[model samples]
Target chain A: MTQVAQAMRDKTAVCGVGLTLGNFQDKSALALSVEAYDLALEDAGLERKDVDGLIQLSFGNDYDRFLEAVGTDVRYAYQGWSHGRFIAPMLQQAAMVVASGMAKAVAIVHGRRRRAFGQLADTEMWRQGLGPHGESPAYGAMGPVFGAAIAAQRYFHMYGGSGDDLAPIAMAFRKHAQLNPLACRTSPMTREDYLNSRWIVEPLRLFDCCQNNDGGACLIITSAERARDCKKPPVYISGMQGVHAGPQFHNLTLPGLGVAQQEVFNYRPQKEDLYAYQMAGVTQKDIDFLITYDAFSPLVLFGLERFGFCGPGEAKDFIKDGRIELGGELPINTSGGLLSEGHVVGWNLFIEAIRQLRHECGPRQVKDAEVCQYGSFLGETVIFRR
Target chain B: MEPSYKVVEEKTGRYLPVIYPEELPFWEGARKHEIILQRCNSCAKSWYPIGPACPHCFSMSFKWDRMSGRGTLHNYVVFHKPWTKWFESKVPYAVVQIQLEEGPRLTTNFLDCAVKDIKIGMPVEAVFEDITSDITLVQFRPGKK
Candidate 1:
């Protein structure tokens, strides 16, 4: 696709955003979902009666309470998971519902506690038993971070980079958290802290992962035309795409040194074309800010490079420059990403993106910010727009 | 430090059993220091790591085909840390996922080489390393070897 083809043209705008109190553990996912809905309704200067549509993470919260909190009968509703792919697409669906006059307005929300349900919803083994094949026969059980760690281990041996190469990713996001008040700020994590942190799944350390907080977040979605009467300056849904080839065994491979069925990043930007390095027409430099879905630190490395922020394997260097910090080259997770900000599944991720574009941040706000980007768990939907 | 990798049975070979009939050939082959996979008889489907039925067809019938163990590197990642306490000494080792010439992907440890020498889509072959009396793992080495 040409650079012009990737340009942002206003489509739909986010009108209101709200986040529930992030808890270490307390209250169910459903309660948090309701709190966020009510707060978002209040934030937009609208009433519960205004939300006629709803979109939520299929794996996370309770839906009946979500419907009750919105005080709407629910004209349009959706729930699914291919990880983060569902986030932006669900918002797009809510936009279509409003645009088609099926509903006047929609509130999308979700929440979860990592300790309660393993946070990432990695239930591969739970489903393994029903299958007649009897997969558990082998010692190789499919856990969430199992494959990712195994792949990372191989990458380190191939690249000769230390585990410390991943530490900067964790420290960078945590450092971004200090300025974010709503973000979980206990201690400033250092690369040494990340290295010294307790191990969870093999190569991944506790500090290298994100907080699985007990919380919910909400975002009000409406068309660009209707948003003028609702709330917040609308950032259009410029270019959005979701792709799922298959499971990891069939799809993924390692970094520059590995092999796989397909070239991993089909949409990855290239340097020679300058513009080719972006997933679409715009470069990372164009966006005022972005949120890297940091469930695990290495993922941020992949996200940084994948989003065309920096060249392949250059995230370590990009991070060292403190560019993702406030007032740096580009600000990230001004709401303190999943790492420090707390992981409310991908629900909080949605609200953070809207909050940044609305310029509502006090200390973490990017100066003269216009365009913004947001992603879900697996980055099925990485929104790019103004 | 010496490079190594091992699996803790957790409970036992009973609770966390490693009994796979489709792997009769791979295991039997391993006893002889050979690596193989089950190819579906009815559908001509090649399955790695072994399975009871062909995902394509419900056929329980398959033949154990020995691999020449030669193929270009499909994709890989070098892990700077081990997945378990057993691999503590093996902090830096490559767990490669290679697409073999016989048309099936295999995940094995890469060794006998430096990290920088590995390249994308590079050729590699299997070299058996026995851990126990009857168990042998198929480790990948540079194909030219």
Candidate 2:
């Protein structure tokens, strides 16, 4: 590991986390964010005055407006657009702010409704370059699901799998959701039920997609020393890597899938792709459980391949026979993931990792969980330790 | 004959591409029934999703050159659910990504092709659709063997 990476390891920890899931049509995004912030402060056993740093994404409120609503101020503040890929970077930035002494504690916050006012729906698809996720609305190629659909089609074409292959991922996460009270779709989903679900896009059923609901989530990051005095055990921010981007790193797809301008090939993670494990002084074997950004089920397969848990095209076989289920070789998305749990813009994925590491997840917890990794298909990752 | 999906009479118009100044040549080429993109003078390569600089060689020096408009269908997906009211009648259509012979991929709709007929590696060619007086979308259809 590099000296910079060594110095950053385990210096900061997620001291507190708060989440609110399910439909809240009456509540505005700002109101939901304020509620989550209050709950986080209470969970951390810290007052609003104790927080001196703030980070947020668009879609809820601007940074200045959020501070005003919370009746507090911070020395360090930042805001980014609301995308699942940015969640890991936001958490990494919070850890850096605390580790670098910019703030004693930093709160990464988010609040979103399913169909909020000013939500970038149709307009985002027509963005100047390519719609974020390669959308071309004139062709009726809209929604983030289009990105997943195209990628899944390419994956199936290149690797030789069908829509039936995705049923296991949906079924596995649904099984995990059965144990999570906050999860949106917990009614038992059988194989027939999965095959019977209507298609949102070919090769992707309605079950492959995540649910849209109003929700809010927050995580408080502070130095490990201060975290020791908090209400819960600190989940140390052991290592991290930023989101990989460019022509090759298409949104919602693994590298070498030839989506957009990407070239077609079998993608394998080289040494640099596995840097987060090195920075944490651990390997895939050390990761007790994993949480990945699963806006769609195809992403779960891509995430596994991106992290080198399996080889290219091997994820189809690797995910079968309950391999990714709760007591399997690698239990992924134990809190049901965004696929089953609810999409809180991926903030809840991190919160799930924190909860699992703390052993506070009563029934859904991984057995003897010590280390967990939040990695995505884009290669953005954050490894946490109890 | 009526379609299966509900059609609203007072429907909001279709979403059109925002024509930026740099992309005027591409839209103009489409209006003239030609497919064009930026070809780098230094690298002698073409790129799509129109950009100022050449992605291959990072060269700002480029020209709007006409393409063969012949490519292989590299990827595609069938959207059964319509995102907007304008696409309600066009449900279960195929949106294909065609890899031009020049090595750049373009995302567009396939014309005069059934969703079941769309397959990877199939030869396809560009066709222009005059959706508006000022805007014409460059689409695709099956090509002769």
Candidate 3:
């Protein structure tokens, strides 16, 4: 609707989905990055020579940092928004580059070994607004979590979702994580254990957030016809859209009531997204599984509502009733979301969606899964025509 | 219980104001502990983080305006997992996004009320916290007489 949609799917296809264990270890972002690059190339049954274009994701990545780490010469180089709202733009650019014959095959990549790399993202400049004329945070609200907390609170009020309801959503993913090899969380999560956890934000508990991990993931996109020769069946970039709204962003107008609600996150606010999902040409009912970006537990529930998988503020009921888990109506985060699987800044979640659609996920795969709709916690909705 | 803050910077000897080269008026108002916004003369649209021109009309016509800071609690949440150590204890604080009467919605911390007292559409007013002698940042508290 308000965000521009993509129109070229029959042309471009994602041929390979590659992800590393993505955890916070001694590995540097660059080393973890190389690991991710190797995985995608090998998985596609190709070599470095097969790639012509490269799209690198940067929230905090320096071009030099990535270029030196991976060590490649490319015909084209591109960057996407680091703050996460511009993923569709990144994919769209990669597709455009390849489809237009700018390059033959494009590798779009994102990764972070945050915990081992540097201090968590808190800086005076970020806390303050950008540009000298900008209005910095009042009382010095310098953390990204501040806006995140605001979004969580709004979802609770609009949906009648309480802390208890939010608790189980994380619990569900934590349970699913046990089956995952790369999952950072090994223990099971119980409701009592969740309630007993310390509070982080009002209504947000300690277990509510995602992990700081060391890993990287990449996708290789080529012409759909050429994709069959390289790797597995291609996951088409069926319907995609990303637009910047809001004054707070240098990319958008100031944060208006509309952009603040949609741009900071579209899926968190149910009212806007329920209407937007209609344009994707499929509804929640059509999706057999999901690969939601669960940076926080409440966020997972908020995503469910935004995707129209359930009614407004009804994600808790959908989750608590076991309707959102394996064999349920919507099997969410089969690869254990950011919380349990570890944060690859949403790339791993994308990998899992492809895995399910390809029926590669053994134990956690949704039975006969066909299509999926993903909620990028950092950006917009992605309906996969896998 | 009351809160305490330490001074970080001082507005000394008139360190250049946001004027001339650019309308550096944002600092001029922030110093007075009042939240200032910009309204475009062409389209009458309100904007924040103050800009060079009206985003709607692309007109540079703008002037300083003050608001009641009264508006609906558009959205909010509580973050407990510590992103940093500086904010470990304030876990239950209501981090809010308020749609100002002037039409600019901002991310802020809601104070002067119990956690449960926070609700959507509740009216709020600005309270500046002068963390530094030179800078005063605008936050919100429950509206009161």
Candidate 4:
């Protein structure tokens, strides 16, 4: 595993970062993808001819439309995230295509008009005849918040968790959002505000949920040799891996089976995150900073544990006052993750990891940061280094 | 007198389950006040959300057996917000997970109880709720102590 990981290490690099449609309105999903793709090419200092591969990172995104809009033919074409979960899996695939000499430059882009279309509830996807269990119609199981709320309740019941323990995780990202101009919610939030926020679902306030925003984020990955000649300093991909800890993610069928299903989600935090880190050969201490996918607040708590930063139930204790804040022992979601920052799915975290690796985040940057890890329970991690 | 077990189709509302061909038998049994689960003939393992074959034995053949209708509350959540207009009246209702004695878990709602009274590890018994003439959604209520 280490040898395989070593083979990919520093072999490919992300040369360009393009974010075009965040917090905007009246923009179509395809338009956002094209805009982000255009900016990525500009940032990489490459044109249509430079991209031999293209990968769509979201559902319903027209690869044909993008191909026509760009007017460029590629030797290789692939679609990532047919389920449209996030970009980690897609990015990992793009890197592999680049590493295997199948493509010189792979352009990966994701676009969403979720807020513009008033589709804030992500669970609605299950209702659109995709999954076997149609949530709202069959059972009143509505959105991601409902599932997250149940998970939080179980965490509280099993681990003795409290809202107070998870408050810092929410506020820390809000603090980081204050420094991020592109973040949707930049206003500073106090602990009182978090507690006072209206409950969307029990144990989860409105603040606990991710903010809906129309956006697109893209990245250009190429061979290390090609990236060295690009405009910006190359940020190396040390390791990347994707692991699914459980069966499917529906509530009606699987329900709380995730807690009981050891094969899908590892009971031990060390084992869960290590499944990815073992390939990269990076430890928790080696990760200077982390960007846990914060679609929900408990996600940070869960991510902290899964990444081996703390014990199974120790995340509630691990995320103490100012511990994950800037200049602390370890900073997380410095770009105001899904909760406070706009939800580009996980793309913002991917872009932020690259920015932090490049030392470009003005105030929110992790000082002297060398290695950064981005991951979530759906189980994918990519360690980026300067 | 006991309530009728017939599932009237016209009475079903917007939240009724859309029964596919494979799920027909489960609903048919629910309409008769019986809880049925698919048990593999080879491995003798039972599973929920019925699949085409046994995950344990990978056998295409299985049996639909009646359950004792008793289980333990694994976990639950009380929805403060409604998902759709149909659920608007059901706000603040607790959605519960029951770990059946047959080794399968079911997502259901509790009847005849307050949301606050629900507890993990508490005993629960399956109860059938006929929403339509052809559809009966299986639910759970507090089991006899």
Candidate 5:
């Protein structure tokens, strides 16, 4: 059997990545977005005028506002949102736009003031608008942690996993955070702290949740040819894909009463990651480091297993012994991840991947790094070369 | 005849399920202590949280039918922390997902058991909790063998 490759693979490259000021609150989400955009332009050695396209999630400042602030003549713009908490979908969209010749360079940006305005679910403005409207919310499944807890519980039941199994992941990220100056949680966390922390939902402790902080991130994507002329080394978008659990029902799906399946729950993302690998023309062994959408700590465990980094239920063992840490077999989340670096959705994971491939991460850099795999709700695989 | 529902403050302070026109029959059935769902006429597939189209076959033609309300508890979570003002008193309560006999999983609370003792794959049955004059929430408990 032959495998057809991803059409847009290596057609576009990420030339610039920028982030706004960290946890310190001062700027509005819009202001932070503009700041990140300016920084990204500077990093790419391109001016506002060089940006012919803009791609952003709705949470960011308006494209017209961004163009007015930067004074760039934008030829194309798109507002995208992906299922679940994935931010890489917009990056994939930007790459396609650039590859199609509709735009020379596209900037994808995301900004959120979740801190200043209070938590998204707690704020009256969002509460009234968003409401606990979903089916699960009707049954007291209001916060993301609740549903995530259920998923974690199911994983534990199926794979002989326990809260103790996730201890190493939390500790590893905390250690990684210690090395990251931009991290929100810099203080070291002991195993006792992880276990003793109050449970938000059983099997999920305080440290399992990602922090809510004020921040924004932007990435600049352009044709592979144009990226070569940029100031920073380009991290090409080799292969990227997003996969949802096939249907709305069952354990693998979100906590909603949409459908039911009789089969044993077998939810894994390895097949999707394998498809991405084939598209990138690389094997799993070629990946030097990886980053996961660590909106919640347990997700890192799921990402590891689902991405085929290890066999089912082996992720708990695979991630131990400094394996996922720097200088280990496959260093992961070199930027400290959302667990420590503050949640900018999954955008930080992509930026961290670029930084690693560019050899910009001085202390947390994975040695001799080339291929970097990123797993979100969907999986994206990119291989970088100097 | 039994009252359609009983008015009470939602324990979790979350919005009660807003019954749209398409879901009126399901709620109407809940009031009668029966589990009703949408069955696609074309594929004979049943679904919960009633909607207009069949998710399996995309068939618009369907009928609301009563389910036996028997299922196995597929998974569950016990909330040790309350997210809203309403659920503070209900802290440490459990929400269970029951894979029903008719091939649909419904999200509801566990009844007649301590949250700590509920186990996965346990056979369960649906029960109703009347929330408002027109809203009755379906919940689950250990099935009587």
Candidate 6:
């Protein structure tokens, strides 16, 4: 590990987390965000004035608007693009701020309404570099699902699997969601139901795609020393890696899947790709549980492969027979992940990691969970320790 | 020959490509039933999504070289859910990514083929569709074996 990465290890920890999922039509996005922020401050046992930093994404409101609503000031603040891929980077930024003394405590917050004013269909897909998720509107290849669908097709073609291979992922998360009261889709989903689900895009069924709903989430990061005195046990930010991008790193697809301009090949994580584990001074075996960005079921497969949890095409077989379930080896997304928990642009996944480390998750908790990871297909990661 | 999908006479609600200033030549090439891409003079490679520099060698020196209009279907998906009115009637249509002989993949629709018949590695040839007086799109169809 680099000296800089070594110094940053476990210096900052998540002191508090707040989340609100499901429809909130009566409340605006800003109001929902403010409520979550208030909950986080209370949960951290810190007054509004105690928080010296603020970070948010561009969905609900601007940073100034949020500060005005909360009536608190901070020394460090930033706003990022409102995409699930950026969530890990936002958390990493907060950790860096606290570690570097830019802020005593930083809160990364988000609130979004489904199909709100800045809808992807209305605007984002029209952006210059193709829709954020490779949405080619001209060909009616619209929505974020198109990106996952195309990647899955390529994966299946290269690795020899079909949409049926994705059933285990959907069924596994749904089982976990049944244990989570806050999960949006908690109903039992059998294999039959998965097969019967209508297709959204070929190789991706309705069940394979995450549901959109109004939600808000927040997580507070502070120096490890200060976090010790907070209301809950500090979930130390042990290691982190930023989102990888380029011709090879497509938005939703893993590197080497050859989506768009990417080169076609089987992707395997070299030493550099697993830098987060190195920074954390641990390996994949040390991870008690994992929480990944599962905007779609195929993303889980990609996430596993990207993080070296399994080989390039082996994730299909690795996720089978209750292996990723609560009682199985390397349980993933125990709080039902974005696939079932609800997508707060992936903030919920981070919150889930924090809760697992704190042992706050009752029925859905992994037994004696000590280490957790929030990894994604785009290669961004955050390794947290209890 | 008439395209299988209905092209509405009223073109108001149709979702057309937002042609960027840099991509005018590619669109103009489509109007003339040809595929044109930026090929690097130094590296001798082509790229997609219309960029200014060569992604392969970082060479700014390049030419808008005309392609053979032939490629292989590298990837595809069928959209069962339509996002717009024009696509509502065209449900279950195949959107493909064709890897050209010169090597960059392009996102486009497939013509003269059913969604089920579309396969990866299938040879496909470019076909032009003049959607409007000012806009012509580059689509693909099954090519010789």
Best by DockQ: 6
> In model 6, how large is the Cα lDDT of residue B91?
93
Candidate 1 local Cα displacement, residue A337, angstroms: 1.1
Question: Is candidate 1 or 5 superior in TM-score?
Answer: 5
- Per-residue alpha-carbon lDDT of model 4 for A1-386, expressed as tens digits? 65776788878999998884355567788788888888888888888799999888544456777888879899888765433244677888888999999999998877888644433344343332223222433556556676667677777777796655678888999999899888888887998988888877777888888877788878999988999999888888888877453354342221222533212233454364455566667777898988887878887776676566776677787788688888888899998888877877677788889988889999888999999988665556888888
lDDT of 2 by residue, B2-92 (tens): 1111112234577677777788888889889999899999999999889889989999999999999999999999999987767789898
Residue-level lDDT tens digits of model 2 in A1-386:
46798799999999999999999989999988989988899989999999999999988678889999989979999998888999999999999989899999999888888767787663677677678988887777888999999999999998998988999999999999999989987999999999999999888999999978889999999999999999999999998999999899989999999999998899999989889988899999899988999999999989999999999999988999988999999999998988888899999999999999999889888999999999999999999999
Which of 2 and 4 is the better model by DockQ? 2
Q: Every model's DockQ, to 2 decimals?
A: 0.15, 0.57, 0.31, 0.41, 0.47, 0.60
Off by over 4 Å in 1: A1-8, A60-65, A68-71, A100-102, A117-122, A126-142, A153-160, A199-203, A244-282, A375-379, A382-386, B1-103, B107-145
CA lDDT, every model vs. true structure: 0.60, 0.90, 0.64, 0.74, 0.73, 0.89
Native contact fraction of candidate 5?
Answer: 0.66
lDDT per residue (tens digit) for residues A13-124 in model 1 = 6777788645647676777777777788778878877777787776555566667654568777776662543565676677657766788777788766555664434333
Q: Give the TM-score of each candidate.
A: 0.72, 0.97, 0.80, 0.91, 0.89, 0.97
Q: How many clashes would you count in candidate 4?
A: 8
Query: Residue B64 error for model 5, in Å?
Result: 1.1
What ranges in model 4 sit over 4 Å off?
A82-86, A115-136, A248-266, A269-275, B1-13
Ranking by DockQ: 6, 2, 5, 4, 3, 1
True-structure lDDT of candidate 4: 0.74
Candidate 4 deviates by what RMSD?
4.2
Q: What share of the reference contacts survives in each candidate?
A: 0.13, 0.90, 0.45, 0.48, 0.66, 0.82
Which stretch of 10 consecutive residues in model 6 chain A shows the poorest summed lDDT? Answer: A115-124
lDDT tens digits, residue span B55-84, model 6: 789999999999998999989999998777
lDDT of 4 by residue, B1-145 (tens): 1232221124434555555567666777898999987899999988865779887778998999998899988878777777666667988887777788888777778888898899989999988887755567789999977
